[model samples]
Target: MQTQSSFKTTETGTLFLVPTPIGNLDDMTYRAIDTLKSVALIAAEDTRNTQKLLNHFEIETKQISFHEHNTQQRIETLIEKLEAGDDIAQVSDAGMPSISDPGHELVKACIEAGISVVPLPGANAGITALIASGITPQPFTFYGFLPRKGKELTEAVTTLAQKPEALIFYEAPHRLKKTLQALLSTFGVDRKVTLGRELTKKFEEFIRGDLEEVLAWATETELRGEFVMIVAGNPAPDATVSAVATESLSLPEQVEAQIQQGASPNVAIKTVAKANGLKKQVVYNAYHELTE
Candidate 1:
């Protein structure tokens, strides 16, 4: 258990979590700007991008690069500065820090070192899009971004498919069609979906409809901005039946059942692994041991 008094004066300085605007510079809060201006140093996901926001607010605080690539190399330095009583502010190019952005590691370091962390609430693309999405707002899961596409992507989507809560995902313009197609294929065409693009900007738009309808719309339209995909919760019975029907079978029996259903060993292993929420290698080893 840990307690934090953000304003308590101590030898170590505070780590202020500052949120920048997702779009529309007017969204910048007065407190966010003041904290940025008052901090001893600023850790930005992209200094070049953050510089523009700083310029607009007339905040001259110096910023250092602290992105995904350099997170490991930079966390220690940021922690050291905090320990030295130099209050620091961490910001991403847009939105709050550490929500599919860099800053989580630094924040973890600060906590371990007993440095104070003060978070200033501001813009967040997911929540911003959610309120206007016409989808069930509460009891939602914010899955920042999907994997580009591979085994990881498959595993991620498969895991989320079982969730009963509304799903929120961020996707790039280029991959919008493909992701929508994947969602349609996995969740079925009739599933409800809402896509928010160019959020908080001049051309902001939301496409709300069934998966197939939105997917068709995406295929025909020229996707031009960042997207927030809000998918309806799983309807139940389908996921439950598959899971329950397979639970009665032993691991090897489950593997053979899939194989009898025309699945190859690799495919069967992957399927059973995902169904049981076990690692693929674990299923593979057990299946091989039964065969051996």
Candidate 2:
């Protein structure tokens, strides 16, 4: 447990976590600009991208590349600078760092090394989209970007399916359709969902409706830009629905049942794997043995 009284004493150089605009340069906060200008060094995910922002504001601070690929190597250098009383500001390509982006490792390292980490709030795609999504925003789970494939993805979707709060997920355009299909399978086709793309920019658009409709729209439309998916939480099951619908069957048995009901084996595996919090491979091996 550590208590951070930021700015109370400048004995050590602070590590500032500054948020840049997701899009629409004007969304960049005054405080973020000031920090970027004031810091000794700006460690950015992409120096070229950040340089553009810095130039726009006439912030002459120098930047070094710090991204997922070079995080381990760069972290040591950043920490050394912090230890040497050189204040540093860390920014991602856009929005907040460590939110489905780099900087988490550096923050962790700073905490362990007893360095001060100060975060300046600015633009965030998830929260920005959520407020406008017309979905219940409070008590929402921000589950960043879901795993790409296999049991991890299935289990992640399944976990979100059981929660009563709104769910937020980030997805690239290429994978958006597949993720929506997976959600349709787990959360049912009628579950409410909203898609926010190119947020805060001129091309920003929001698609809101049932999962099936949204999935169809996404499939037919020309996909582009990053997406923030705001999905309504699980509705309360009707009391009339049989408890046996859930409790009577074990996990492997459940997979077999879904397969019998015309679900593909892969789909059933994903759904069941998520429901059981087991790996897809584990469920697959068990299901095959059970059938054989």
Candidate 3:
């Protein structure tokens, strides 16, 4: 129940979330440049990588490391500085902060401390690839990166497969083939997909086709740079069938049924819990017949 008036005058310093260029330097907005030059301190994901951008823009503002590994350690210090009315700007190596980057924790801390959080929108790879993907872009979900583990990945993809909106995912070149294969198995061979490689760069390329075609192309081609994948939604989701299948079964029985269909216990619990609008722990406890 907290309201944030971004431009309102306040004694505490504002925490600016600045976006850097995803690929093309020309995409960097003037506002982003001005903020970078003006902030008291720049909390960057990687100081070395960000220094290159600072040098290019002639921004001499100092930077402190604020990545995943050092997030908890840095939040206290950053909050202290903001409380003292020294404005700070946070940036990632590229793209918007906290969008698959390391600025979320700091942003949360700032909110909790009642510091102003100002976001300057600029380059974003997900939306950049989406518009040109030729897929319906209105109802799209930006799923940053999928779980890397086998069981976890299966559960995540299974849940996302039921959604009716276009799904966007980011993947490294090394894991591109495996992720595409995972999507092929869950989304089926005929699902429409587009793969944008090295987006906004000189060697940018887009592959548009069905899942099967994209999988084949990934197998034969040598992948380089990062990629953005746009997967078409399920055109004919059978929600009625799912509802009917679970209505007659007890919660534990419903979980058992999913396991019989080859889902792991955790995955089965998640599916049944989501279907019944209950928590996973509740389903897990019921399925295991735990008294506590």
Instruction: Give lDDT per model, in order.
Output: 0.83, 0.84, 0.86
Clashing pairs in 1: none
Query: Model 1 residue 21 lDDT?
Result: 90
Q: Which stretches of candidate 1 lie over 4 Å from their true place?
A: 237-292
lDDT of 1 by residue, 1-292 (tens): 7999888889989999999999889999999989999999999999999999889889999999999999999998998888888999999999999999998988888899999989999999999888888888888999988887444554566567777888999999898887776565446566788999888899989999998899899889988989999998887724522431254687778777655544467766776776676787888889888432
Q: Using Cα atoms with residue i matched to residue i, what is each candidate's TM-score against the true structure?
A: 0.83, 0.84, 0.83
Residue 221 error for model 3, in Å? Answer: 0.3
Best by TM-score: 2
How many clashing pairs per prediction, in order? 0, 0, 0
Please estimate how well model 3 matches the true structure, expressed as its whole-model Cα lDDT: 0.86
Model 2 poorest 10 in a row by lDDT: 237-246
User: What root-mean-square deviation over C-alphas does model 1 reach?
Assistant: 6.0
For model 3 the local lDDT of residue 129 reads 93
Off by over 4 Å in 2: 237-292
lDDT of 3 by residue, 1-292 (tens): 7999999989999999999998998898999999989989999999999999999999999999999999999999999999999999999999999999999989999999999999998999999999999999979999999988766776787778778899999999998887887666555567899999898899999999998899899999998999999999878664422431355688788777666544688887877676666788998899999876
RMSD of each: 6.0, 5.1, 6.6
